[model samples]
Target: MVAISSPGIGSGLDINGLIGALMAAERLPLGVMNARKDELNTDLSAYGRLKGAISDFKSAMGSLGAIDKFSVNAASSSNDGVFTVGASSTAAPGSYSIDFSDNGTNQLAQAHRLTSLDFADTSSSIAATGTLRIDLGGNSFDVVIDASNDSLDGIKNAINSATDNTGVTATVITVDSGSRLLLSSDKTGAANSVTLSDVSGNVAATLGMTTVSAAQDAIFLLDGHQVTSASNTVTGAIEGVTIELNALGATGTTETLTVSRDIGAVQENVQAFVNAFNDLQGMIGYLSKGDLQGDNTLISIQSEMRNIFNTAPTGLGTSLQFLSEVGIKTTRTGELELDTSVLNEKLAEDFNGVAELFAHDDQGYAFRLEALADRQLAIDGIIDTREDGINARIDRIDAQIENFEYRLTLTEARYRAQFTALDGLLSSMQSTSNFLAQQLGSLPGSAAG
Candidate 1:
C-alpha cells in the first residue's frame, strides 16, 4: 500500500497543520543556537579588529625603540655646489678635507653608446639566419635572427625583447640619409662598453655599429690622493659613505665634509612618539566602550602599559632617566603631552642621554613596551588564547546545532508517520460506518424509495 502523502484527504482532520505546529515547537532550540553562533561571530570580528590595532601599536613602539638609529651620522659638505654626500647609519662621526683641482681631469662617468651605419630603410632585410652574441661588461646575451625577423626593425625588436638582454636598449632612428639602429648601454664606465660578435651569421657585420661615445671612469682627488670610480656616485671612498660628483670643481678648491650625529632628528622622533601613543590610547578607549567592554585581556594590557608611567628606569648612567625630565608628561585626562620648549632644551643639553632614555637595551620605555607587545602578539599569547577559546566554544556550538538539526529531522519524520497512520485508521472506520448504514436502510424500508 502507498503511504498517504496528503494526510488529511481521508480523515479530514488537517493532520498536516497539526504536524507543522508540533515541528515549529520542536525547532525552537535551533533558533537559540543560531543566535548564539551569531553572537560568537560578532565577538570574533571584534577581536580581529582589536588584534589589528594591537599590531599597529606594536610597530609604532618598535620604531620608537630603535629611534636612536635615526640619530646616526649624516654626511654633509660645506659647499654642495659641486657635489653632495650621504652616509649610512654605521658611518662614524668625523671630518675630512677633499681637495679638487680641474687640471684636465674628468670627474663624471660616461656611458658607452654605439651607432649603426645608416640602413636603406626600416624594412630592409639582411642576413636572415644567425645569432649575435652581445657583451656588456661581464654580462652577455645572444640575439637569434631567423627568416621571420631578418629586417632591421625586426632585429631591433628582437634585441630589445631578448629575455637575457642586460641594460641594453635598441632604438631605430631615421635620418635624411637613411634609417639607423642605435644601441646604448644603460651602465656607465669603460668596463660596461657594448660589444657584439656574430656567432652563426653576419648579423654583427650587417649592423655595422661604431662607438658614438667611449665609456670613461670618474676621477677625483680625496685628501690630496687620487680616487677613481666607474660611476659618479662613489662609495667606499669613506667607510659607509657615498659621494656623488655632479661637476668638476674649480682649480684648487677644497671643501670640508663632516659626518656627525643628527641631534635635530631627536625632536621629531619624540613628537612622533607622542602622536603614536595618543593614537593607540584613542583606539583602546573606543574599543572599551563597545564589544570589548570589561574584557580581561584589554584591561590587562591597559593596566600594564599605564604601569610604566609610575616607574622610572634605574641603573642607567644618564642625567635624564625619567620621561617627565624630557618634556613627556601625563595630563589629568590620562593622555600624553609634549612640552616642545623643554624637549628642545634637553636635546641641546644632552642629546645622547635622551636617546638612551627611550631606547636603551632593556630599561628604556620604548624597548619595554615593544617587548610587551611582542608577547601579546606571539603564538599562544593572551589574545590568541582568548580567541582560540572562543573559537572552540563556537565549534562545540556548531556541533550541537548539527546534532540538533539531525534530531529535528527525525522528529518531524516521526510526527508525519504517526499522523499518516491515524489518518488511515479514521478512514477505515468511516467506510465501515457507511456500509452498516446501507444494510440497515435496506432491511427496514424495503426499498420505499
Candidate 2:
C-alpha cells in the first residue's frame, strides 16, 4: 500500500504553513535571479532602440555620401510653353539661347499619318486576296487582305494584330458617308516615318490612302549653331542636357535656357542629414535615461560620429575640406546645425570644391561614417558582439535559475518529510500520555469528574 499520511491530521500541527515558510527562505535567491533577468531584458530592449538609430544614421550617411547629391543642376527655360529643359550630371553650368529654325521652317517634328478613303461599311468585303508590306522605323510586317477578312474593320484589325507590326497602329474612323481606315506611325520624327507598299496585292493602291501629315525632324538653333534631332525630345545637343521642344517656334523669337548648379538642392540634402543626426541625438538621449545610462558602446558610437564631422578630410587636394566650411556646426547641446546661407555661398563660389568636402571617395566625412556604421552593424561587429555577450550572460542566468529551481524542489520535499516525521512522533507521544491518564482516572477519580 502507498503510505498516504497527512502530517497535521493526528497531531493538529500546521505542517503546510510551516513548510511554506521554510521554502520561502529557500527561494530567496530565485527572487534576485528573476530581477536580474528583467534588467538584462531591459538592456536588450535599449540596445534594440540604439541599433535602429544607428541604422537610420547609416542610411543618412549613404545619402550624404552620394556624389550626385553635390552635382545637382537645375535647368530653366524662359518660355516653358515653348520648350522645357533637363540637365544631367555631365551638363556644365551654362546658358544657351534656343530658336526654332528647322531651315527657317519654324515647325516641330511630326508623325506620319496615312488615311484611306471611306468604305460602304465595316464588315463588307473591301479587297480580294492580297497582301501589303507595312514599314515603320526599323520594323516591318505584312498584312494579308483576303475574303476571310476584307472589310474596313477587318483590314484595321489585320494590320494592328500583325505579328511583327513594329511601330505602326491601324484604326478605323467614322466619316460622313462610312467608316475609313487610318494608319499612323506609333513614334514621332522623320526617321520613324511609316511606309506602305503593295506586296502580292493591290491593297495599298485600292484603298486610295492619302497622306494626312508628313514626317519631319526638329531643328533648333542653339546660340546660332544649328542642332537637329529626329525627335522633339532633343538630346546630345549640349552635354548632358535634353531639350524637349513643346511647340513650333518662329525664326525671329527665341528662348533662353539656363543651366546652373543647384545650391538649394545641396542645402536641402545637408539640412536633411542634420535633422536626422539631431533626431538620433535625441533618441540616444531618451534611451540613455533608462537601462542604457552611461553605456560605453553608445558613447563610442556618438563619439565616432562627432569625430567624423569635426575633423577635416585629408588628401582631397582642395581648400574646402571641412564640414564647417560649408556651415554645418555642432551646437552646445550636441545637435548638428546647418547654415544654408553659408552653404549656398560656398556652393555658388566653387560647387565641385564644396562637393569634395562631403562626397570624396576616401576621406569624406560621409564615407568614413558609412564605413564606421558598416563595421558597427556587420556580423560580429560592435553591436553584434555586445548583443551576443548579453545573450550569453542571460543564458547563464537562465541555467542558474533552472538549476536553482530544481534544488528548491528537492529542499521543499525534504522539509515536508522531516516535519511529517516530527508530527508523527509528537502524535504518538500524546497518545501514550492519554492512555496513561485514562487508566489513572478510571482507578481513582473516574466518578468525581
The number of the candidate with the highest lDDT is: 2
Model 2 TM-score is 0.77
lDDT of 2 at 10: 75
Counted clashes in each candidate structure: 0, 0
Best model per TM-score: 1
- Those runs of model 2 whose alpha carbons end farther than 4 Å from true positions after fitting are 1-45, 101-103, 387-449
Task: Give all candidates' CA lDDT scores.
Answer: 0.83, 0.83
* Residues 220-265 of candidate 1: C-alpha lDDT, one tens digit per residue: 7787788888998899989889898877778877878899876566
lDDT of 1: 0.83
In model 1, the runs with Cα more than 4 Å from the true position are 1-4, 72-87, 91-106, 119-172, 179-181, 194-209, 220-227, 238-269, 431-449
Clashing pairs in 2: none
Show the lowest summed lDDT stretch of 10 residues, model 2: 100-109
- Give the RMSD in angstroms, all C-alphas superposed, for model 1: 4.6
